[model samples]
Target: MRELKILAVVVSLTLLTYYLVEPFAHSKMHPHVDAPNYNFPQADKVTDAENVEKAKVALEEAEKAGKEKAIKSAKTDLANAEKFEKDTNAFWASAKAAIADKGNVANGEVLVTSNCTACHSIESKGFPPVMDNASAAAAYGVVPPDLGTAGKLYTKDYLVGFIMNPARASKVTHKFVDGRVHPMPGFDWMQPQELADIVAYLESIAPKTMTDKEVFHNACQRCHSIKYGDMQKGTMQAFTPDANIKTYMGKVPPDLSQYIKSRGAKYIHEFVNDPQKHLEGTAMPRVGLTQASEKQVVGYLEKVGDSKKAQREELGPKFLIYLVIFAIFAWLWKSKQWREMH
Candidate 1:
């Protein structure tokens, strides 16, 4: 019994050491080459040129195969861009009607106080104080126009244009010394009434606080206000959304709309469940999902995409695989020790 116990201990230690040493030993192993070359950079450049030509051929073939697909995608982008143009016309019409209505000023006050305070501060009772046009001119050397009498300075069409894309407005005509390109960020995320409220409230504030007060320090104030004071944030494309995720998978990720439209819901459901089936060389990891949860996400995309809902359906298989592997290793270790003991 004593000899058996000692043998079992020795066997267990040997197994544990083998497991730990295997990774380091593998790393140190050398290639059995006739001439060992340490210059990966030179080799990589030569390999890269060959790969580039191959990629060009592949891309041309893909484009040829999906010419209609490419055109459809471009059209979709054009349609979404046009939506903004229509929204602008509707916004101005609403603003003009609201100014004529008696209750509009009151509703505008509520809307402005809630959404505009993050940047603008007009002195309304029980509201955060914003620098009036006069105060702003005194401090910043630029007069911010009062919004209250907007009809006098800007036509209804002009107001609509400004609301739609404030950054694109002309500098000379409006004495909008701040221009449509004023440092003030546009109110894009707000609802239609909320945007109208801001417009209405600005129209009211022009006369009351015409003087400019000093601008406060904000998240972008430090670097932007000092160095790029005169420069506008350009429409430069720095980082594309989901680019990193696509790079990891070694493939160009299709635009969400095109992927869904071409492949159909069932393909997306299976691809999310098991990427290996759709593309053999795809580096995207499988995130296991239940049939029911997959259906829920498919239903959601009919209205809008919800990543959180899809993820909740998918993350289980990875966890299950880890547990299974760990169990198998533990069982093997125990069984080997028991045999040594006998």
Candidate 2:
């Protein structure tokens, strides 16, 4: 009994340590999402247009003031803007031509049925009827999303890129706290046309009216919840006399109301793409979401979590101080008890 009591104390302290340090560990492991260095020619044109307008205004003011240096600077800005536009147009034209060819949707359907059905469901009610949350959560740490709504959630280009190489397409490099890499294996062996066909098939079957919240409901609510105001919303079924979720999950999953504030947007994105990377043995599985869908989910998390983060963070130090005080008193009490026993 004494050994058992010591073991219980050790286990309790281990769980306490995990809870206290988890946020700090996550912050250290995955910082804020950094901007990608890759240039987007299409988006640059809008910035160039704004620069051109500013330069024109500067030129007019310089000429009115008879300031040669200011006039020269304005002309330089105008020249740079024109050069950027010219280069951007050329790049955009070439990129469009390279990816101009469309894929066959019929072939894509065949491919999806043959290759993807084992781990994924193409239809909402098909063979191996969309694996239930518990079984899927047990098998892969999370339920695989039905592909029927995927086309609506993702763009054709993003779908193609992800199907070809999930890790490369995601561009996530942060190592998980446990040092596990992404669980997704790349299918780079597939030809471009074949991948394109799969994208087409996905698009063909995707629901057109699926909203961001609906996407979260479909893909995430199974293991996560969002508490807003006074209402709690989630996909998990309510527990009853016969069905206790704790038996399956060990404990109820954490509420995602403040997840973005706790984990950061980049961490969320990386985790969604592959959760095993950030947390080994995590019940959250890779949802195989397109970049757009992932962004939408993260956007929702940020919107809900951003408002109260400052207040929460402000209280963290106070909590730590209280814990220290409590620990000191507890130790003093234990020492006094031993003295009295002697």
| Cα lDDT over the full model 1 | 0.42
Residue clash pairs of candidate 2: 141-283
lDDT of 2 by residue, 112-178 (tens): 8987777776556364644565565555544555677777775554455556544334333222226
**Most accurate candidate by TM-score:** 2
For model 2, state the Cα shift of residue 306 in Å.
7.9
lDDT against the true structure, each candidate: 0.42, 0.62
> Which segments of candidate 1 are over 4 A away from where they belong?
1-103, 117-143, 171-182, 200-342
| TM-score result, candidate 1 | 0.24
* Candidate 1 C-alpha lDDT tens digits along 164-245: 4453222112223343334444544555554555555555653431111111111111111122121254221212223332
Q: Which one wins on lDDT?
A: 2
